[model samples]
Target: MICVDASGVRLAQPDKVLFDGLDVTISRGDRVAVVGVNGSGKTTLLRILTGALRPDSGEVRFGRGVRIAMLEQDPLLPPGTVADYLGDGWEVAAVATSLGVLPLFDRPTDQLSGGQAKRVALAKMLAENGVGAAAEHDMIVLDEPTNHLDLEAIEWLEARLVSMSAALVLVTHDRHALDRLTTQVGPSKVVELDAGRAFVHQAAKGSSAYATYLDARAERVDREAKEESTRKILARKELAWLRRGAPARSTKPKARLRSANEIVSGGPRDLGVRGNDLELGAGSTRLGNQVVELVGVGQRFAVDGSDAVTVFRDVDLVIEPGARLAVVGPNGSGKTTLLDIIAGRRAPALGQMKVGSTVVVGYADQHAASLDPDITVRQMVAGPLREPDHEDKALLERFWFDSTAQYAPTRMLSGGEKRRLQLVMVLARKPNLLILDEPTNDLDLDTLRSLEEFLDDWPGAVVLASHDRAFLDRVADHVLAIEPGGTMRRVPGGVTGWLEERSTRRSASPVRTTKVADAATSSSAGAGASGGGVAAGSRGKQKQASSGPSPSTIGRRLRETEQAMVKAQKRVDDLHAELASTADHVVLAQRGEALAVAQGELDELEARWLELAELQDG
Candidate 1:
């Protein structure tokens, strides 16, 4: 059944016509992804789909009694507590807990952070698990649903979306989710908007829709290139005829020649201004040997003047010239705090952070504090200057903000556009040392490619935190991993190297070193709260018993537990898929029970797997 049907639609803005004569249809069981460059009307199209905005001219028809659960990028919280907004139910609790928002149930909705609000909104949409509010909705439309989500939460959201029977339409930069979208009954589809036109790519059964879209887009690009060549040839012939004064018009001389003149003037601009890769300028900085170094760095906060809580303690790291370091860990692992200390934005309570005298730091912050929403894009870059010189304009242009976009306020920009603007603001400073946090979050695919290209050859020491797998693999030379326990270690390889050992890390033991001094805890939880030197690295090895389970036996059990965990997880996924594909109430109830059982078994198996891994290594 069709959820939304819009044909011959048109929308326009002050600077450009977003789209013209657009035709779109979303039906139940269709997994559709809308892709476009920043400000290409991705969000506008979603609004039109949900009937929030009326097109200038079109026929928009929804299926009879259709219902849609829409999640916008900036969601408004309803007036109530979190628990009141989402009903009291087990299904709701399960999804909310997965999103890391269950702890906020007692807090007022207005008191929650932006990330918390986003997760709460997501959980509300998914709480039904396709048997309550979700089942009633004929379609679900979301915009940038993965922006504030962590890696684990993103995975859970992907599974939940796949398990819903409602039609799925979303705009996102998450590459993982785009590849795994296999709907219950229909093939996955991608609608890419470019140059006021929409191109549809549909994947065949059991194939990756995103990969198919890339191949198709490449072919279309080649086709457009050939067509441009033909146009150029025709224009040249027409130009020669016009110059030769060989063709005489009857009455309308210049008027009849207008069409040919337009053809000659239009090739790339008429198509679009998606030209020239992003260029980054680095004003020369003579660098010494040292970049940024943190010696015995640690931070702790006092709890109401009664006790102290330590975030991380006794850390030491050195960054030199030409270093490419990627800080990675699960969310809330103090990655951002470490980066801030390195940038000199914040100081550590227990250690020294030294920056080279010649170091010019340019920080692209996750929450861009420099972006003034009320100011124009050009003003944000040029500060208080009444007239931004030609260089400032050119700099903004290089980052895909054309003249019209430069004149527009930053508040008017799309999510991706705002991110691109933030990058411009940071790079305009030409700092030799760059510290970027979550830099690839909302950037378009093309912009990401351009940034990667720039970082590939740019002569600068870079440090960043990102979850984009491809970006991390291409840009980082070394990896710094942080655990929830505040343990930091340098992984030999970057993301790829760490991922290679992720499956077996459970059985791997932390390498211990003899710290000639005592390691002291800064928290009141431990007795040793003060020390002269960093003692964080002296984790004494747990001696193995000679009469307990043999090492070989533990290794065998570890392998067996891993196999069982994988099997049980696969069973859970299969059950979710089956539950989504069916509509019979009785079948759904039965499958739900089985799914719960399977999930519990999977969790138990995973816990056992970790225990065996520790036993094997310890």
Candidate 2:
């Protein structure tokens, strides 16, 4: 059944056309994934679909009794308690509990942090669960749902969506979700919006539709390139004719002459196509051998003016030159605080934190406070530098802000644009040590990819705290985790390794509590709250009293061992493929190292499988 259909849609922003004569249909059970470069109107299309905003032209028709629940990228909730807002529905409570926001039921909604508020808002939406009597089936629209979610929460949300009996439309940059969760329902279809036009590819369900769309898009790109080449050739001829001041030029229509001129001057811009050679400029500072050091460094805080809490204790870590570390933990875990401490914005309550003399830190916190809404793009780019100059203009253009936008106010820029400007401001200083707290929060796919590419070869020390699994895997060489009870440990296996462990833990313990759920009351919750740490980790090590697998548990152990082996081998194969295809010297070196690690892990898995097999045979 058709849930909603949009026909002849048109939306335009004074200077740019967002959508023109676009058509879209969302049917029941359809899991549509909307993807495009930033400013390509994905969000606007979503708003149009839900009928929250009317398009300049066209009509959106909803099937009888179509109830829509939307999770906007940033939602506004009226001031009230979380419970007051979500109502007392069991399903809603269950979702809130699972999302780790049940503890905030009594907390004023307005007082919650941005991340907390996001979770609360999501919980309220999921609480609806698309099962109300108002509609035949609920249509759920989510924009960047995983932006603030941790690995475990993301996994839980993915599970919930898979089980949900509703039509789902989402916009996200998470490749994993696109591959794993979403699948075409009924007839296969792909609806991709590029600039204002919609391109639909029909094929088999699952990845086949996505694959077909990509192939078709690539062909279109090739054809356009060829057409542009021909246009340029003709434009050059026209220029020569015009230069001669021929009498024939006067007979030609002025509009035709203008078109010829535009063709000669780089032609009319296709805002949708960004030249792949996007540069994130400003090389980093020359780092000395030492970057930063923490000796017995720990943080603690007083909660309710009584009990003292430990964020982390007796943590010893050294940030080496050109090091890449990803800080990870549950919500409220001192990931942000940790970054602040390392960046010298905050001092450790205990132990010594030392910064290398050569280190000039560039910090971009979650709040993006460095940005000034009243300032123009040029002003923001110039920042502390004396004045905006030609170089600054060039830099802004490189980051995708054209001449007009460079002079426009920063407040008018889209979320993605603001993030791009923020990045420009941060990197322009050429700091040797870079600390990014949730940097991927507002960045679009293009910007995220560009930043990841830049960081790959950046000659500096970097520390990032983010929940983006793809981003973490691409950029982090190591991981610093704040486990429950404020135990800070350097985990093995970067983000991938940590993810595997997390998955295992979820399977072993079905009911896990994040710091957001247990922060106020648990003894160590105070430590997590006071020290600004997150209370999440393995439920300690599971006790293995038996030397070998017990007869009752042997079957489970055998299955687990087999699964682990398969996963390890897959990692080895993926690493090998990456190593073979990569051309960048730095990337090849990184992949080579990853291949070695995967090989070692595969060997260990094989050894463990053999041990488990022997135990079962006995």
Candidate 3:
């Protein structure tokens, strides 16, 4: 059955059109993935199809009584409780529980973090088991749904998508998910958009759609080269005639001289796309006997108001100067916490954790929150270095940050750009030991591949926590598994062995009651009181108390927030700004909307914070 049909759709801005005369049709059981750069109108097209946005001109018609569901990049949910959102049905309850969202039933929607909200949204989407099959609206669209998810959540989503009978259209950057889920769904079509033009190709795992695109790009380059040669020849002929004492019969060529001049003077260049090349220095740092050693390291905390509950215990691990260790476990298994303890970002609850005398450690946190938001690309790169004018610019350029981006703030950067920046920052320290928690998250396939190559060549020790099977296989030589009972074991093959062990353990262990705890109390309570619940009156009182603080303090906080937003914006803006300033002006002009959106979000956040402060005072 036909699921979606959009005809002659047009999306435009004041200066240029994003998509015009675009047409697409999705049928039942179709697994389509929309491929494009950060702002090639991929999400816009999804929104248009989901009826959240109207096209300037065109018709979008769904099959009769289609019960379509959409998981947006950032979904705006209602303010009520999670149960209200999921309804009071048994199937809904089962799905929510299985997805670990049922414990959030009593929690307010506003308190949910990005990852938590994503899980809630996924639970809501999958609540009606077989709804796609039963209701005859076997169609679902997901936009960047994997963002902020951990490894376990990603695996769960992949399984859910594979089992669905619906036609799934997804826009994602996760290659593993795409490879597994899309393969299970069979050969689906791929729609690639470039410069408001759609290129459709049959999707295959390794050598299908991407190969076709490469061929097309090669052909375009050759054609453009020939055109350029012809234009040069014609220009020489015109110049020669003008220079000589010319006859009246040679007044003008067949084609209009002005038009030919336009073509010759302004034509697209033979631009070749180069992938990421992250080369780490091979000079090893001298180690003082031991790099990192953990003896009888254990972590325990109170669970549901009970006595200290053990998450992991009796874990003894050691890393020399050049050891590469991969930590693997299920969601909420404390892999990240253990890394944080070893990196000195967090203190261990018990036992001893130590770094060698000569070791300097660099840590890339699970969420990449170490970045300072108020700084420019150049400032971030040249931290602690003075007069970084030429040196900083060159370094940034090496990481694909150009002139415009070097000056732009970091707050506006995309996920991939921020990640690249983080990698550069971590490498700048030249530490002997590197601790990476899910380092491949939010990175593109090409970048991930480049990182794998870099890790393989680097001489320093690495402790990596990741769920990316392919990445672990490439970079990790030793595997450490955090078993369900909080014991750490050295496994055989890095990721494969870990997976096999997990499967065996799951099959052998008796099923326990899985409950989704409140999000605020789950992993965030010890860090801050932000997620904790307070009575409405008490909350108001606290707000009033904070508002009464000195003007200078309020100003300082506001300034900090502004700076943070600026830093984030700068990173995002630098990537595109650098690309635009260096690339063809026409392409720069074409990508204006995306840059504007990034800037607008930063502005909006600043404005919202200011508004909140004012409300608090009033």
Please list all clashing residue pairs in model 2, or write none if there are none.
309-527, 310-527, 332-533, 333-533, 333-534, 334-532, 334-533
- Each candidate's clash count: 1, 7, 20
Model 3: lDDT of residue 444: 55
How well does each candidate superpose onto the true structure, as a TM-score?
Answer: 0.77, 0.79, 0.68
184-205 in candidate 1: lDDT tens per residue? Answer: 3475788888877777778787
Distance from true location, Cα of 509 in model 3, Å: 4.3
Q: What residue runs in model 2 are displaced by over 4 Å at the alpha carbon?
A: 130-137, 184-191, 201-203, 208-213, 249-259, 265-268, 271-282, 514-618
lDDT of 1 at 359: 90
Highest-scoring model, TM-score: 2
Compared with the true structure, all predictions reach lDDT values of: 0.73, 0.73, 0.66
Q: After superposition, how far is residue 265 of candidate 3 from its true place, in Å?
A: 7.6
